[model samples]
Structures are given as structure tokens and as C-alpha cells.
Target: MRKTTFLIPILVIAAVIGLSSMFIVDERERALVLQFGRVVAVKEEPGLAFKIPLIQEVVRYDDRILSIDVQPLEVTPLDDRRLVVDAFSRYRITDVEQFRQAVGVGGIRTAEDRLDSILRAETREVLGSVSSKDILSSDRAALMLRIRNAAIAQARALGVEVIDVRLKATDLPTQNLEATFDRMRAEREREATDERARGNEAAQRVRAQADRTVVELVSDAKREAEIIRGEADAERNMIFAEAYGADPEFFEFYRSLTAYGRAIQGGNSSMVLSPDSDFFNYLKSPNGAGQ
Candidate 1:
């Protein structure tokens, strides 16, 4: 009975020791073997890994991609406009050995601080050299690329591979929004006023042109009427002169008759003349013989 009891205890101790000496590392995890708190081996591949029980320890880390949420902060752009940026980063551990040396027992928390600082500094450097409009435009992608590249170069010492840098949201600071809106409104109003003034000036020009056309038409009409009247007078004088040349006595008599009619043209008219007046010659003799 004593031998059986001692054998059972030995078997149980062996089982415990064997279980502690070996560890199964999942594909999603990386194991770092340490002896006396000093790194001895880094197991990046998956499967069973062996370690001396009670003397060696295995620290596991996530090998999968990780994400860090950056706190929102303000950045001033080249245009002197300030914006609040909410961004995040995706990263993964590429060099576990170096990670251990840099972080020591501090682990992922210590590495995060350094990585975030690099990302933020690079973002600020890129954003500061560009105008606010550029940051808001499609060129933002290029700026983000610059930030990621710069961050990747700086994060090499941290044993991390920065996969991408992304901005979730960007906005004008609350304090500046009202001023920007007011300026925009003022600019729109100025443009509207200018458009109206230009329209009015154009209308005035059109009206002046129309008035000048009307004046030219009236002046031309008056001039044409005067020309017609002068031509008619000349033709009438020529006709009368031709008639007088064909028959002088008859023309003289006719002219005397026309003078007499004109002298009495008014509805109420009277004239007193000598009874021996030459005007009476036509009345005294039809042949106009008594001159």
C-alpha cells in the first residue's frame, strides 16, 4: 500500500511538470520564452513550444493586426484655420525580439505611447504645410499617405509595422465656425450686389441705345420731309415758268386772278382800292387791253 501511494503522487507531479514544460501557441499569437526575466527565444510560428518548468516563462502577444484609437486634437493648417481631427491607426508587431528589448516588462502599453506620438507628429507636420481647403479636398488622401510613410519610418525602432493611418472625421473648431460662416455670407452678398449693379448698367446702356435710335429716326424723317418739300417747290416753279413762257399775257392774267383770290382767301376779308387800279383792268376788259 505504501508503494502504490508513493507512485500515485509521483505520477501526478510528473503530469503537472510535463504540462508546464510545453505550451501550445495559437496561430493568432506569438510567444516569447524568458529565463530569469530575460528573453531567451521568440516563437512567432504557431504550434507546441517547449520550456523548462518553474525556470522558464512564455509571454504571449497578439500577432494579428491591432488598432489604436487616437484622441481628437486640433491642428492648424497653412491657411491659419484650425480643425479638430479624430483619427486611428492600424499596426502589427513585425519584430518581436526588438519589441521585447524596447518595451521590457512594460508590454504593449509602453509601445503604444511611442507609436501614437510618432503618428501625431507626422500628421501635424503634413497638415501644417497645407491649407484648410486642401485638407478638406481630395488631396487629403495624398497627405495621409505622407503621414503614414513618415510614421512608418519613425516607428521602425518600436518594432512595429504601421499599416495605415486614417482620419475618421475632421471639422472646423466650434469657435471658428461662426466667423467662417459670416464671412461666407458677406462674400455672397457682395457678389450678388455686384451682379445687380452690372445688370442695371447693362440695362441703362440698352435704353440709351434705343433712345438714340428713336432720335435718329425722327431727325431722318424730318430731313426727308424738308427735301421732298424743296423738290416740290422747285418743280412747281418750273411748271409755272414754262406755262408763262408759252403764253405771257394769259399767265399775267392768271397770276392777277391768283393774287386777287389770295387777297380774299379769309372767310371774313375786305379790301379798298382805287377804281382806276390796275387790278380793275382784268375786270374792265377780258382781253387785258386796258393796261
Candidate 2:
């Protein structure tokens, strides 16, 4: 019975030691075996792993890509324009052994903090070399690529690989926003003023041309009317000369009658003359002789 009791205790202790020594590493995880706070072995593949019982412990880290959001920071471009930039990064622990050695017991959190600093410094350096227009434009993809490349060099020391760096938002600072809007408004107003001035100049030119055309048309019509009046007067004088040559006495009597009609037109004219005056010849005789 005593031997049976001793065997039971031995088996129980062995089982406990076995359970504590064995560990599992999932496909999504990488583990480090630490002895007295120092890493003794690294298990990168997913499977069963073993370590000394009561002397070592297992520390696991995510094997998948991780993300870190950098706090928004201000960057000044070469143009001296300041912008607020929010960014994020993707990274993966490439060397588990190196990662543990660099960050010690702090693990992923410590690595992330160090990575954030590298990213911030690289972002400022790359973005500051360009103009604000480039940072805010579609070319920002190229700028982001530069940041990732620069960060990759520094992140290797922390045993992490920088996959990508991207700007989430780029904006003018609150104080600069109003100033930028005012400048834009002023530019638009200047363009409008130029357009209006051009329109007014064109209108003035058209109006002057119209006035000149009107004067030319009126002067042409006046010259044509004067020519027609002079030709009509010449024709009337020619007709009178031919009539006088055809009949002397009749022409003389017609002249006298025309004179009398003019002197007494409207039957309200008054005149005093001798009875035997030559002006009465046509009234006294049809032949215009005072017989």
C-alpha cells in the first residue's frame, strides 16, 4: 500500500512537470523561451515546443502584420507652407530573436513606440523636401513610398519590417485655412475684373464702329439727294427756254400772267400803278400789245 502511494505521487509530479514544460505555438504566433528573463530559444513555426520546467517561460508575439496610427503632426514644406498630417504604418516582426533582444520584456508595445518615432522622422524629412502642393496632390503616393523606404532602413534595427506608410489626411492648419481662402477669393475677383474690362473695351470699339457707319450712310444719302435736285432744276429751265422760242407773243403773255398771279396771290395783295403801265399789257389784249 505504501509503494502504491509513492507511485501515485511520483506520477502526479511527473505529469505536472510534463504539462508545464510543453507549449503550443499557433500558426498566427511566434514564441520565445526565456530562462531567467533571457531568451534561450525561439519557436517560429507553428507546432509543439519544449523548455525546462520551473526555470523557463514562453513569450508569444503575433506573427501577422500589425498597424500603428501615428498621432497627427505638423510638417513644413520647402515652400514654407505648414500642414497637419495624420499617418499610419504597416509592419511585421521579421526577426523574433532580434525583436526580443532589442525591446527586452516590453515586447510589441515597445517595438511599436520605436517604430512610430522612425516613421515620424522619415515623414518629416521626405515631405519637407517637397512643396505643399505635392503633398496634397495625387503624387503623394510617391512621397509615401519614399517615407516607407526611408523608414525601412531604420526599422531593421528594431527587428521589424516596414511594409508601407500612408497619409490618412493632409490639411492646412486652422489658422492658415482662412488665409488661404481669402487669397483664393482675391484671385477669382481679379480674373473677373479683367474679363469685365475686356468686355467693356470690346463694346466701346463696336459702338465707335457703328457710329462711323451711321455717319457715312447719312452723308451718302445727302449727296445723292442734292444731285437729283440740281438735275431737276436744269430740266425745268430747258423746258421754259424751248417754249419761249416757239411763240414770242404767247410767251410774253404767259410771263405777264405769271407776274400778276405772284403779285396778287390769295386775293389779299394790294398794289398802286398807272392804268397804261406795261404790266397791264396781257390784261388789255391777248397778244400782250396795248391796243
Candidate 3:
């Protein structure tokens, strides 16, 4: 019984040692076999890898593309326009051995910090030459390409390959945008006020012209009416003169008859004229021939 218990403990320890000596390198991972804190071998191929138990350790790194989103930064363009920029980079560890040597035990965290600094530097250097209009336009693609290329060159020291660097957002500063909107509104209001003033001036001119036309029309009508009345009165007077000249005696008789009718127009009228007066001659003679 004592021998069997001792053998069981021995087998368990051996099993643990065998498992510790072997490590896995997955398809997505790269491993560095370290002996006493010194890197000895790089296992990049997928499958089982070996390291001396208790003396060697395995450090694994991701082989897939890594992404980092940097903080929003403020940049001044060549035109002096200020913009807030948000950016990111896509990269991967191309040489695990170099990455291990450069980054040491810090791993991905250290790599990302270095990459962020490089990306920001490259972005500023490239974008500083461009105007905000270009940054916001289709030319932004070319600008991003330039940044990616520059960042790649600098980040190569870290054994990382930059696939792309892109600007996620480029926008006017909040205070700047608010000020611009206020200026635009003020300009529009000024234009509107100018237009209204011009319209009112035109309307005043038109109204004055209409009032003058009305006055001229009224004066012309009154002048024409007075001319026609004078002509009619002159014609009537000429006809009366001609009738009087044609027969002087009959005209005098008619005048006397008109006077007699005026004197006796009232029913209770009393006249003291003699019966042989010329006023009664019309009533006395059948023909209006006075005595």
C-alpha cells in the first residue's frame, strides 16, 4: 500500500512537468520561448512548441491586425483654420522577434503607446500643410495616405507594420462654429434689411408717380369741361342775337309778353297799368303788333 501511494504521487508530478514543458502556438498567436528571462526561440507556426520545464517560459503575442483609436486633437491648418480631429490606426506586429526585443515585457500596451505618438506626429506634419477645405474634401484620402506612409516609416522601429491611418472626424471647434453661425445670421439680417429698404424706396417712388398722374388727370378733365361750357353759352347767345335781328317788332312783342307773364304770375296780383299800355298790347291784338 505504501509503494502504490508513493508511485501515484510520482506519476502526478511527472504529468505536471510534461505539461509545463510543452506550449501551444495557435494560428492567431506567435510565441517567444524565453529561458531565464532571455528570449531563446520564436515559434510562429501553429501547433505544439517545446521549452525546458521550470527554466523556460512562453510569451505569446497576437498576430492579427490591431486597431487603436487615439484621442481627439486640435490642429491648425495652413489657412489658419482650427479643427478638432479624431483618428485611428490599423497595424500588426510583423516581426515578433523584433517586437519582443523592442517592447520587452511591456507587450501590446507599450506598442500601442508608441504607435499613438507616431501617428499623432505624422498626422500633424501632413495635415499642417493642407487647408481645412482640403481636409474636409475628397483630397482627404490623399492626406490620410501621406500620414499612413510617414507613420509606417517611423513605427518600423517598433517592428510594427502600419496598414492604414485614417481620420475618423474633422470638424470645426465648437466655439468657432457657434461664432460662424452668428456671423452668418448677422449677414443675412443685414441683407434682408437692405432689401426691405430698397423695396420701400421703390414703393415710395411708384406711389408719388401715381398721385401726380391722378392730379394731372383731374386738372385736364376740369379744363376740358369749362371749355365746352363756354362754347355752348356763346352759341346760345349768338342764336338769340340772330333771332332778334330777323324781326325787331316781334322780338319786342315777345319781350313784352314775357314781362306780362312775370307780373301776373301770382293769382292775387294787382297791377295799376293803363288798359292802353304796351304791356297789354299782346292780349289786345291777335297779331303781336303793338299800338
Candidate 4:
């Protein structure tokens, strides 16, 4: 019974040690065997891995692509326009051994922190070199590629491969938003003012042309009327001269009658003249002679 008890305890201890010496690494993970916090072996392939019991430890890191959301930061573009930018990145640990050495016990958390810094710095550098219009435009695709490339170069030291970098949202700062809107409104107003001014100028030109046309038309009408009036007066004088040449007595009688009609038009008219006066010649004789 005593020997059986001793064997049971020994078997239990051996089983515990055996379990501690072996670890199963999934296909999505890479394992690092560390001795006293020093990486002694790198297990990249998925399967069973071995480590010294209680003397060495294993650290597993994801072999799959990882993602990080970088904090939003402000950047000033070439035009001195400031914008707030939110970004993210896809990355992977290409070298587990190097990653282990670079990050130590902090593991994926530390690597991500470093990667975030790289993305931010590269983002600022790439975005700062261009105008805000480019960042906000479709050309952003090219700019994102540039950022990824720059990040890939810098992230090498962290044993990470930057697969892609992208800007989520690029916008004006909250305080600057109102100011930008005001500027836009002002620009629109200025354009409207300019258009209105041009319209008014065109209207003035049209009005002046119309006024000139009216003045020219009125002057022409007045000149035509004066010409017609002078022609009519000449025709009447010629008719009178013909009548006088055709019959002297009849023309004198007509002239005397026209004068009498003018001198006694209304019933209240009064006139006093000599009885044998030439004015009474038409009344005394039908032939305008004092017969």
C-alpha cells in the first residue's frame, strides 16, 4: 500500500512535467521558446513544440494578419490647412524570433504600440507633403500607398510587415469647421455679387442703348413732321397764287370773305368801319367792286 501511494504521487508529478514540456501551436500562431526571458527557439510551423519543463517557457504570437486602429491626429498640409485624420493598418509578424526579441514580455501589445507610432509618423509625413485637396480627393489612394510603403520601411525594425495603411476619415477640426464654412459662404457670396454686378452692368448698357434709340426715333419723327408741314404750306400758297392768276375779282372776293369770317366768328363780336371802306366792298358788290 505504501509503495502504491508513492508510485501514484510520482506518476502525477511526471504527468505534470510531461504536459509542461510540450505545447500545441495552432496554424494561426507562432511559438517562441524562451529561457530566462531570452528567446532560444522559434517554432513557426503549426504542430507540437517542446520546451524544458519549468526551465523554459513558450510564448505564442498570432501568425495571421493583424490590425491596429491608430489614434486620430492633426496634420498640416502644404497649403497650411490643418486637418484631423483617423487611420488604420494591417500588419503581420513575419519573423517571430525578431518580434520576440523586439517586444519581449509585452508581446503583441507592445508591437502594436510601436506599429501605431510608425503609421502615425508616416501618415503625417506623407500627408504633410501634399495639399488638403489631394488628401480629400480620389488621389488619396496613391497617398495611402505611399503611407504604407513608408510604414513598411520603418516597421522592419519591429519585425513587422505593414500590409496596408488607410485613412478612415480626414476632416477639418471642430473649431476650424465653422471657419471653413464661413469662408465658403463668403466665396459664394462674392461670386453672387460679381454675377449680379455683371447683370446690372449689362442691364445698364441695354437701358442706355434703348434710351438712345428712343431719342433718335423721336428726333427723326419731329424732323419728318416739320418737312411735311413745310411742304403742305408751300402747296397751299401755290394753289392760292393759281387762283389769283385765273380770276382777279373772284380771288379778291374770296380773300375779303375769309377776312370777314375771321373778324366776325362769334355772335358777340363788334366792329366799326367806314361804309365805303374796302372792307365793305364784298357786301356792297358781289364782284368786290363798289358798283
Candidate 5:
């Protein structure tokens, strides 16, 4: 019984010792073997790992991609307009030994700080050198691409790979935004007023031209009417003169009858007429001239 008790205690101690020396490394975690707090080997693969109990240690580091959100920065463009810019970067560890030596097992804070500085400097460089219009429109994408490339180059020495650099938001300061909106509104109103003035001027011109054309058409029509009336009067006068010249006696008799008709038809006013007057000579007979 005494020997069995001794063996059981020894087995328990051995089991505890074995447990301290053995460890599991998940597929998602990378293990770093450290001796006396100094990195000796880096195990990036998953599975079981061994270490000297109480003499060597293991530190685990994340191998997955990490995100870093940078703070908003103020930038001034070539136009001297101040804008707030929020940015972020994505990175992953590529070299574990170099990463531990540089960043010291801290996940992404070190990389974040480094990238933030680079981003601020580059952002200032890019924005200060570019026009506001270019930053807002034409060169936004290109600027982002250049920033990414520059960040990648800078981050390489830190054993980190910069996957992307992005601008989260860009906005003018509140006071500046209000002022710009007012200016734009004023410009639009001015344009609208000018357009109205031009439209009114054009309408006036068209109306004046139409009136002039109407006057000309009316004048032409009046001239044509006068010509027609003159032609008719001339034709009637010529007919009468020709008949008078062709036969003097018959023409005289016809004219005398026409004068008598006009004298009686000159309204219903009172008039005295003498009996046996020369005006009756035409009514006497067709051949009663001397009568």
C-alpha cells in the first residue's frame, strides 16, 4: 500500500509537469517560442507545440488581417479652404521575427501610430499641393492610390503589409460650408436674373419686329386697295367720255335725264320746280328735241 501511494503521487506530479510543457496552437494563432523572454523561434503554423517547462515560454500572435482607424485630420487645399478628413488603413503581418522585434507582440497599435503619421504627412502634402476642385473631383482617386502606394513602401520595413488606405469622409468646416453655400446661391440667383433679362430683351425684339411687319403688310394692302379703286374710277370715266364723244345728242339727253334723277333724289328736302321746264324735254318724246 505504501508503494502504491508513492507511485500515484509521482504519476500525478509527472502529469502536471507534462501539462506545463505541452501547449496547443490553434490554426488561427501563431506561436512564438521565447527563451528567457527573448524570441528564439516563431511558429506560424497550427497544431501542438512543446517548450521547456519554466525555462522557455511561448507567446502567441494573431496572423489575421487587422484594421487601423486613424483620427480625423484638418487639411488645407491650394485654395486655402480648410477641410476635415477622416481616414483608415488595413494591414497584416508578413514577417513575424521582424514584427516582434519592431512592434513587440502588440497587435496593431504600433502599426497604427506609424501609419497615422505617414497618413497625416502625406495627406498634408497631397492636399496642400492640390487645388480644391482637384481634390474634390479629378484627383481624389489618384490621390488615394498614391497614398496607398506610399504607405505600403513605408510600412514594409516594419514587417507589415499595407493592404489599403482609404479616406472615410471629407467635409468642409461648418462655417466655411455655410459661406460657400451662400456664395453659390448668390451666383445661381445672378445667373437666373441675367437669363430673365436676356429673355425679356429677346421677347421685346421679337414683338417690335412683328409689329413692324404687321405695319408693312397693312400699308401694302392699303396701297393695293387704292390702286384698284383708282383703276375702277378711271375705267368708269373713260367709258362715260367715250360715249359722250361717240354721239353728242344721245349722250346729252342721257346726261340731262341723269341730272333730273339726281335733282329729285337729293334727299326728301322741299324743292320747287317750274312747269314746262327744259328738264322735261327728254320725257316729251324720243325724237321731240325742238319741243
Candidate 6:
């Protein structure tokens, strides 16, 4: 019983010591062993690792890429068009030793802040050289590439590898957009109104011309009709004159009878009678002595 009691305590102490001196590195993590707060060794592979029991400590860093989203910032294009830009960065700790020596475990936030400042400055510098039309058009990719190259160089000095730099969103502020749209709409409406006015003017001119043509046509038709009627009347007069010349005695007798009928068919009115009156001669006409 005494031997068993001693052996159990010894085993417990050994187990505690073993646990304190050893650690496991996961495939997804890299560790740095620190002694008295100084980096003594770095373990980059996954496996069991040994260290001093109480004096040494381990600091672990993620081996996978980390994503940090920057706050939205205001930027301007070459045309002085203001916009809000939201961006993010993807990075990984490539050299754990250098990363630890440069920035401790709690320095990721500071690194992101620094990177954000650098990215914002460089983004403005790069995009400021381009026009707003180009920024909104097919040249956005080329601008992004240039920005990434500058950002990568900046991030490398901090012992981090920049996987990518991306602009998530670019937008004009609401108030500015509203003003711009209003101006654009007004201009378009002005153009449309001008076009409609020109069309109306053309239509009025064409209608006036058509009215004048109609008047001329009516006058031409009236002239033609009057000429035809005059021609027919003249031809009838010539035929009548030729017939009257051939039969003078018959025409005289016929003219006397026509005059008697015209004088007698009348309402009675008082008239002074003369024996030599022409009307009376017509009433007595059919006698050959009447001239």
C-alpha cells in the first residue's frame, strides 16, 4: 500500500510535467516558442513540439488567409465626381518569425489600420488620374490592378503577403445623385421639346403651302370652265347668224309673231295710245304692211 501511494503521486507529477513541456501544432496553425517573452524558435509544421516546462511559451498564428474589410471612404474621380468606396484585403502570414518580431500576436488590428490608410491614399492617387467615365466603364479592372500592385508592396514590409485587394462598392452619395439626375433629366427634356417644336414649325409651313396650292388649283379650274362656256356660246351665235342670213323673209315673219306674243302677255297698265306706236304694230302684226 505504501509503494502504491508513492508511485501514484510520482505518476501524477510526471503527467503534469509532460503536459506542460509539450504542445501540438495543428495543420492549420504555426507556432513560435518564446522564452522570457523573446522568440526562441518557430515551428511551421504540424506535429508534437517540445519546450521548457514553465519558462517557455507558445504563440500561434493562423496559417490560412485572413480577410479584413476596410471602412467605406470617400474618393474622387478625375472629373471631381465624388463617390464612396468600400474595400477589403486578403492576406496571410508568410514568415511567422518575421511577423512575430515585427508585430506581436495582437497587432493584426494595427496592421489593418495601417494598410487601410495606405490603401486609401494609394487608391485616391491611382483613381484620381482617371476620368469618371473611364472609372465607370471598361477601365475599372486596369485601375484595380494598379492599386493592387501598390498595396502589395506596402503590405510586404509588414511581414504579410497580400493575396488580393478589391473594391467592393463604389457609389455616389444620395444627395449628389439626386441633383445630377435632375439636371440630366432637365437637359433631355429640353432637347425633346426643341425637337417637337421644330417638327410643329415644319408642319405649319407645309400646311400653309398646301392651302396656297389649293387656291391656285381652284382658280385654274374656274378659268378653264369659263373659257369652254364662252367658246360654246360663240359657236351657237355663228350658227344662228348663218341661218338668219339664208332665210330673211321667214325670219322676219317669225320675229313679228314672237314680238306680238311677248307684248300681249302682260298685266294691264294704263298707257297713252299712238296710232304709229311700235307695240301696237306688233299686236296688229301678221299684216304684211307692218314694218
Identify the leading candidate in terms of lDDT.
Answer: 2
Q: Over 4 Å off in model 5, which ranges?
A: 138-140, 225-291
Model 3 stretches astray by more than 4 angstroms: 1-9, 174-178, 205-291
Q: What is the TM-score of each candidate against the true structure?
A: 0.75, 0.82, 0.72, 0.87, 0.71, 0.78
Worst 10 residues of 3 by lDDT: 282-291
lDDT of each: 0.90, 0.92, 0.90, 0.91, 0.83, 0.83
Higher-scoring candidate on TM-score, 1 or 3: 1
| Number of clashing residue pairs, candidate 2 | 0
Give per-residue CA lDDT, model 2, range 1-291, as digits (tens).
999989999999999999999999999989999999898999998999999998999999999999999878899999999999999999999999899989998988899889988889999999999999999898789999999999998999989999999999999999999999999999999999999999999999999999999999999999888898888888887888899889977888788888987898785678999999998867777544644
TM-score of 4: 0.87
Query: Which pairs of residues collide in model 6?
Result: none
How well is each residue in 11-43 modelled by candidate 4, as lDDT tens digits?
999999999999999999988888998889988
- Per-residue lDDT tens digits for candidate 3, residues 104-133, read 899999999888988888888888998989
Worst 10 residues of 4 by lDDT: 282-291
lDDT (tens digit, per residue) of candidate 6 on 140-203: 8888888878888877877888788778888897779989899999999999999999999999
* Model 1 TM-score relative to the real fold: 0.75
> How many Å off is the CA of 11 in candidate 5?
2.7
Candidate 1 per-residue lDDT, tens place, 1-291, comes to 999999999999999999999999999989899999898998988899999999999998889999998778789998888999888999999888888888888889998988888888888888999898988887688888888899997788978999989988889889999998999999999999999999999999999999999999999999999999999999999999999999998999899899888887867788899998998778878565545
TM-score, cand. 5: 0.71
Worst 10 residues of 5 by lDDT: 266-275
Question: Which model is ahead, 2 or 3, in terms of lDDT?
Answer: 2
Order of candidate numbers by lDDT, starting with the best: 2, 4, 1, 3, 6, 5
CA error at residue 286 for candidate 3, angstroms = 23
Clashes of 3: 0
Q: After superposition, how far is residue 198 of candidate 2 from its true place, in Å?
A: 2.7
